[model samples]
Target chain A: MTTENHPIDQLFKEKLGSLEKNPPAGLMDQISAKVAFRGKIRRMNQVKTAIGIAAAMLLIMMAGWYSMDQTRIAKNQMPLQIPQINTPALAKTNQESLDIKPTVNQIAANQHTIQTTPAKNTSLQSAKPSKSLTVQKNKVVSASVSDGASLLAAQTASKEPSKAAKQEENTVKTKAAEEKTVVKEKSKTESGSNNFQKKNPPLYFADAGVVKQTPSRESGKGNWGITAELSPSVASQSVSGATANTTQQSTVSGGMLASYQVSKRIKVSSGIRFSQMKQDTHTSYTLSQTSGITYLQPVDKAANLAGDVSLYLPAVSSIVYSNGMKTNPTDNFTSDIAQELKYLEVPFQATYKIIDTYLSVGVTGGLSTNFLVGNHAIITQNGINLSNGSTGNVRDILFSSSAGIEVGYGLAKNLIITIEPRIKQYLNSVSSNDQVNYKPTQIGIFTGLTFSFN
Target chain B: MLSVTQLEEIIYKCREENNGAQTALYRLFSSKMYGVCLRYARDSSEAEDILQEGFLRVFTKIRQFEFKGSFEGWMRRIMVNTALEKFRKNDRLYPVEEMSIYEATNWVDETISSITADDLLRIIQELPPRYRMVFNLYAIEGYSHLEIGEMMNISEGTSKSNLSRARIILQKSVAENFGNEKKLVKKVL
Candidate 1:
């Protein structure tokens, strides 16, 4: 549509085009009022959008920084992450002066499996000194054996093969004690036992607990410890009357746990945790039949005062609309509404270590009380935030029980990495609504890093 | 009476939302923009309504102007847009005829300049909203049919048709006012 040969264009161009006639009187006042109004509205809308974006960005940044810092702190806390109480005791076995004979002595020193077992003293010279130290192929395993008793025990056992013929002439009577009840320090030097006795630390057993305990460190029995666990929880809701399918998005739970070893193999623990159960109930609820015609405004004034329950009125002329618009009375609406319930859970659990080796396998069962911190039931019609509502008749206190198998690996001396695939069942309904008995259950694999205190 | 620099200073001050500068700025351009509003509107009161609305937009969006092009031209565009918005809202109500009339006629005869701008303005105002809006955008404002279509929210073809209809109507108005070429006037009638 090019204007190549238009005629009337020329006439209008000549006549009224760019005409500068004066407008009506006092028009400026009207303009002033309107412009001021527009400016206020525009500024308000811009401010609202800015605030929303800023809040979302701030939340994400804080969450990311927190996660990174947590990982770094947890990493710095494992196998011998705690300082050694006696360094010379740890260094005795690491001496490189050993020829092939002492190297065989190192293999003898590593026989901790027999030493730790009271029933069968078949010791294994375990070579894990620290979690950070990766196994070096040619490096002597003696560096990992911190105790002198084990080194002498291995050396004596290895020396006996050479002296087997003369064993009757040199019968050394050494008293070997139970694994936990203290064993008196004993060492038999090949030439003279005095040199070996002098090299062994006078008293290392009392201060030995200062070194970090690896979760499954064969000889490690931790006294006291703390652990932090994080898990992504999957929750499903079970109700009584109406059929509702509930789905959750991004349900994460994190908690700090503290444990005290009641015995050598059992630990009693308690901790504070944060967990949320968000349920999106996709349900078609039938409205009780109204006898008279009820005209609902898109933004009903009464909706705000609905007192803990909001009726999500949709913007449709098909039903009873605000401006006296009416339609056929009986139509059931099937829409989605998001209901979130947050809890500050306190769990009192006991863990029994089945095999406290390099990889510790344990069975854990816990009783937790989930305080119904927040329950928000927002009624949305076609994805519009109509109003704030309550999860009607929600019980404040909820009791739950959980059980899981905790598998912990000694990452370093004091630091242990653990994973527990746990399932929690609600003892009572989270919702007190008689018509809907909503009991939610969550299952997740909880990952944690444990730091030993003593 | 103000120089270009003085006008710009007033505009800058108006952007800061000074009442004095805003009134001064309004006084400076209101007359010329009112003339534009009159062409699009049905009467003086409607024209005044359009002028008031356009000026309100000008004041609210004063900060957006970087002073690159002509200030008057920018103001004119705002005024035209304000008029067009009014037209879109009320376009269906206003009466105009079918397009597809013959084109390539002599624009206005020897008596074209004899009629006053006000008289031509009146003839333009008499047109239905769509025809009047298209005619004013294409002829007076020097916008292309495509531009008119975009401004008026219509197709370029529709723009051209409306322009043609506006022209045929104006030709009869011109012929009747000058009282010449009885047959041509009757043909438009």
Candidate 2:
């Protein structure tokens, strides 16, 4: 019942089980090439994923920084309230001291009243007390002398004239000595008040007792900032050796940048940027078949990021019709092939401020390391996609240098809106293929929102 | 032929992705693997494709191969799986009509000896894709009907049926190609 013992199984196994045939030549080379290429692609994908995650984290950090900065600015804008003192009570004490007559006992009592006053009053309040005491001492001294003279005249009529005159002379001498002492005390009080005024200059106006503290404009200056920039980029390329006519197409570029202010007029920045170059070539091609697989082979090399059309078209060499049938070799086609190359660019730039003010202008220049992340080429005939593939000879890494003028306007205490018109030129050829030399140039007016961390 | 120690050394080098070692390994096993591919492939070109893809997988995934069982057996399994995947992608299984059972033909040893492996390979390749797969897995590879069903994504009954049909068609071809030769050999005897 076992199929193993069956005649047909026995026959085929005995004859074909150990059969070996030499495979066609050059297959090993093909496999090796594929393995290396796939390895590169795998590594590229890993790097791209890492960059993507890092970019996302950068954005989150920027958002958090911006939110915290706004809160700080709001707190800074709030008005400062100065402590109010009971000025009327102090004025009443001054009036009461002034109205009392300056006998030796009354003078001693006034000195005690001045010493007992609280020290927590404003500088003006404290100075007023000393000034008022000096005035009171002077007024009391003069008024006491006048009253004593009047009392001496009244006493002459009521008693012995000689006895009265001798008593008045003793009383006048005592009053004159006390007035000299009061005058000396008043001069000391006046000097003390002048010294207090000199030491504690009033921050608040005497008339308008409230203090309003506005945050200084210099508080907005910080060493670090994060900018999110975007631009509609115009991409073009120069070709040294290519026959096909190629036209540049407009694309978009943007990124988040972290900047550090090194000095008042100089700033350095580094971050990730995304850029793309697209080109369309109108060319003629011949349909070729290899091992029953159809291919659209270009007649001439096209000027592109890859520099050659063969690399793009040969990747998906087989051309399948709309009905899922392979195309015939006899079919010759003329079409426009569009190739787009995208890169993840990391730029190290420095900006020098020409005018660092609310409306600031700066000149920026830098070099960027661009990693090729996306490369795609597609052929379309009459709105139908004929074939799609990727450019092969495009370099994985490219170097570019950019220069621009940055014009920024301060929108808030911690925010600025900037517009930078930049021109980037590739430092090396985009293609690794030796058939053609291609270098792409890009111009973009980048508009960005910058948040400062002070 | 490589000794066990030498084979392990080559495999070690392959794990490091040494191109020389990879090429050496390919040179050692490619012919045998291509033979296996040819049985499952419709043509030499398809066999070459399978061999190329299979060797690429072997080189890339060499690190995953634990030195448990036979290395050749592991590689053979990869080649077969590669073929099966290609078959699944390229061909859809269609329902086959009920066929008459093919009884074993009695032939002289000389007539059987006259048929070469290439002739048998050609006949096997001519079978329908599913039947060819089921027959190869069941007959030459010595897999069970249930195992063939799982590998080919068919029911066990369907596997058995396909193997029977494949055998019937193969038997008719062998008989047609070698029946007259057997008669001539009998006449000479």
Candidate 3:
């Protein structure tokens, strides 16, 4: 007979065997789908928000530049307008001769008569002699001699009366002379006014002439001009406690650029742009792994410059007025937002040319489509075995909106070489993942060419 | 009742988020898992408590299972972990042992193999806690002396001695049950 078995073993085996007969419950279905869908929608909204904010900011900047450009044109034209006013005044003075000719001749005749009459009165005063006066005999001798003398004196008296009359006339002439003095003073003032009018003619004429002569002076100065610029810019940033360790991420990537004018500044450009940007980042980390003893290790290294490209549909508008309104120009190249990859932005820059050739500074800003293509992962363990097993996966979206200055010089009439170091900072935290902590903002540099046209 | 292929399929499907498969899986494995829980428990009720908790954890962590080795081997590890946890909780239940004079008792070949399943079960029930645990793990559960040593944190020699003592006690009880059965047979005759 077979050896009898312990009943507990059979019971244990039976219970173990009986597990084949039971099963667990089902899971809740709709909640999981809702969570996944919400994740996709949230990602899309984040991208749109980045683009929208960039567009609004660009619009504000372009508007500011356009207003400034208009003011500049007005200032340049103001000096030229002065000459226009002077030219018309000179022409009016020439036309005034038609009205002044008759008055001039009449005044000359009156002046000549007044001058000769004064000379006759002066001679008559000199010819008169002083004499003593006696009574009757003196009057008789003076009468018989006075008869002859009387005749002579009467004649002389008559002559003297005539001379006295002439004197009276002379006194009238003096009064006339006084009146003429006022008229001459007025004519002198008129001539002085004409001289004042002559002085301003050259100012208005020269300013207007310079402006007219300068219409094509900036011929090679269009949108594609090479520009070389250096911007000493600084950004103040406060990162969250989690991102503080990655603070070496702050960077300055600006350089001198020379660019030519591309076109009459873009009023608005509605097209796609392909942009590629590269960033060489160096990170220094000090990691201590305490297995038995505390091992302190410092790693200082630079990562290869990574390239990012974005396809942007930018609604680009000009910063300077095309048809005198703030509205953008109606052209094939004009749009409301200049869209491109935020990281790899082909900036449909609305550039306002401040000056030309020697030192031209333009403010260029546009919209960018922020898309996250890849990410960097940092696995850190503090008293936790982070790499031991499959604990969790962390996903973050860093550096969404990209912006910076593009400064350079005009290399030629049609080419502007520029260097743009951009900063892409995330508006929201990169990690929506609750399990792991991550850092999200990044800075980079871009160098490219611009073609300008008139 | 489930074949190995069936168990593998159920676990795979459950990991893939199939509800019907998960339920089938739970039903198929629950009873045997209950037995594993019973070994580490002080009573049937405690065993049932462990069964529920163990199954819940097993299902929750099932996705982490990489099909590298035998599924049964994995399950066994989980059951042992559960048992060790119970032992830690009930440490006070183990009776204190005192060294005494060395004497070997008569070891009978009680012919336990000839006894009915019910009689053998009664013999196991009559054993003290220390003896029962040792005997169950060594004889029925197929744990080697070394494995038992590691699990209970004792020397392998201690596991061997405990198993030997438990077997002797179980043998005597089985002999008595047989004697009683013989008397009943005589009476019936």
**Using TM-score as the measure, which candidate wins?**
1
RMSD of each: 28.7, 34.5, 38.9
TM-score of each: 0.45, 0.43, 0.28
DockQ score for candidate 1: 0.46
Writing each residue's lDDT as its tens digit, candidate 3 over A1-454 gives: 1122544344334433223212122222232344346456667657645653444344334434544653694343212101111334333422331123322222221111111132333333233321111112210100000112211232333344455656654664464455456667778998998899788542210000000000113533333233222122233233232211222322222212223334533222212222222221223223222221111111321111111111111111221221222322232111111111112222233444444343444444444343343332221222111110111121222333445554544333333344456555545433343422333344444443333344
Instruction: Give the poorly placed runs of model 2, Cα more than 4 Å off.
Output: A1-3, A77-454, B93-101, B180-189
lDDT of 2 by residue, A1-454 (tens): 1356888889998888877888988989999999999898778657655654454355445445544653684333222211122456544443333433233223322121111111211122222322212222211221111112222233333232355444544554465556567767887897998899799853321110000100112223346777777676897767655566778878667777888777777778888887888877877667654432334555664444455443222212333332334434465667777778889898899888887776888899999999999876766554433444555567899999999998876555556667789999999888887765777789998877666677
All models, DockQ values?
A: 0.46, 0.40, 0.07
User: Fraction of native contacts in model 3?
Assistant: 0.16
Ranking, lDDT, top scorer first: 2, 1, 3
Candidate 2: Cα lDDT at A348: 91
Ranked by TM-score from best down, the candidates are 1, 2, 3
Better model by lDDT: candidate 1 vs candidate 3? 1
For candidate 1 chain A, the 10 contiguous residues with the lowest summed lDDT are A204-213
Count backbone overlaps in model 2.
0
TM-score, cand. 3: 0.28
